[model samples]
Target: GVLPLAGLGAWVAGAGPVVLPLVIACFGLVAWGLHRRRARADCGETKIHKEGVKP
Candidate 1:
């Protein structure tokens, strides 16, 4: 949230025009990766439970 806000502020402040977009893109990619990782972890847990694994 801070990073995104910084990016927006920088753009509004007229700091390079490319800065905001790049920051947004990077933030999005990171968020997406994290989400995918969480989904995979959940799936793995479900599979383990289905297999009757004691954990």
Candidate 2:
């Protein structure tokens, strides 16, 4: 989880200050992907419901 990653990053920070941005970017990408997937799923469900399909 992010907590463990945060702790590890804190330790790593003592050596350098580059991993933080990489970690943040990775989380941002993951969040964006999940949001897009959910939006697509909702759109599909709406279409199915509108068509009277019992989903």
Candidate 3:
């Protein structure tokens, strides 16, 4: 949210085309971090449909 808002502000301030790409990259990083955390929580398996899956 902050990254996108800052990017928008930069674009409004005439920082040119770099703002959107930067914002997108920031969002991607955030999403990747979340995905990694979730993967770690499931022991890197990415799917845990059974109740006895946890060690």
Name the top lDDT candidate: 2
lDDT-based ranking = 2, 1, 3
Per-candidate local distance difference test: 0.85, 0.86, 0.76
TM per candidate comes to 0.66, 0.70, 0.51
Candidate 1 backbone overlaps, count: 0
Residue-wise lDDT of candidate 2 within 8-48, one digit each (tens)? 86777865767667878998999999999999999999998
Q: Which regions in candidate 3 have their CA more than 4 angstroms from the true location?
A: 1-16, 44-55
1 or 3, greater by lDDT: 1
Q: Tell me the lDDT of model 1 at 5.
A: 81
Task: List pairs with backbone clashes in candidate 3.
Answer: none
Q: Please give the TM-score that candidate 1 achieves against the real structure.
A: 0.66
Of candidate 2, the 10-residue stretch with the lowest lDDT total is: 14-23
Clashes of 3: 0
For each of the candidates, give the backbone clash count. Answer: 0, 0, 0
Better of 2 and 3 by TM-score: 2
